[model samples]
Target: MSRIVYVNGRYLPYAQAGVHVEDRGFQFADGVYEVCEVRGGALVDEGPHLARLGRSLAELAIPEPMSMAALAHVMRETVRRNRVRDGLL
Candidate 1:
């Protein structure tokens, strides 16, 4: 199956997901990320991971890409789209 990815505010197939070459994250690594594990379709330590991500962004003076709630929704949606029940997310 083709993997799905979230790019900007849309979900697209991995093959079609592309970030601009000049995007700040790509050009200067101006962002923070989190990799949370998914077990039985539930995120592990989601709260802590998000908190850490917020702190990292703050430390780097980078704006959040979206609200915490929205980011959380996206994370869950991405995992669902990929049908990942137990794996790193």
Candidate 2:
């Protein structure tokens, strides 16, 4: 199966993934991200990770790219597509 990556509200083939060169996350290292562990198709420490993300965003005064619910959806979908039973996001 072709790898799918979520980028700017769309999931695309990994080989086709691209981000605007000017996006602050890429250009200025201005962003907050969370990495959660996945096991048996379920996210571990998700709530804490999200809470930390929120804190980081608040501390940096950077707006969240999407709502928590939206991010959760994306994370789950990415894991599902990757068929990852155990991994990190």
Candidate 3:
């Protein structure tokens, strides 16, 4: 199965997932990322992880990529599409 990734509000095959060269995250590393573990098909410490992400974005003066609910949906969908039952997301 092709690995799926979420980018810019769309879910695409990993091979098709591309970030713009001018993206701040890629150019200047001006972004924050959270790695949440998945166990038995469920996220671990999801709330804390997201909260920390919000804080990080705030510290960096970056606008939120999406609402919390939307972000959560994206995370869950990505994990489901990738079929990751036990691994880091």
Model 1 reaches what TM-score against the true structure?
A: 0.93
Q: Whole-model lDDT for model 2 versus the true structure?
A: 0.90
lDDT of 2 by residue, 7-27 (tens): 989989899999899898888
Cα deviation at 2, candidate 2, in Å, is 2.8
- Preferred candidate (lDDT higher): 2 or 3: 3
Better of 1 and 2 by TM-score: 1
**Which tens-of-lDDT digit does each residue in 1-89 have in candidate 3?**
99999998789988999999988889998778789999999999999999999999999999997897789889988999889999999
Q: TM-score for each prediction? A: 0.93, 0.91, 0.94
- The residue ranges of model 3 lying beyond 4 angstroms of the native Cα positions read none
lDDT value, residue 53 of candidate 2? 91
Worst 10 residues of 3 by lDDT: 25-34
The true-versus-predicted C-alpha distance at residue 64 of model 3, in Å, is 0.5
Which portions of model 1 show Cα errors greater than 4 Å? none
Instruction: Give one clash count per candidate, in the order shown.
Output: 0, 0, 0
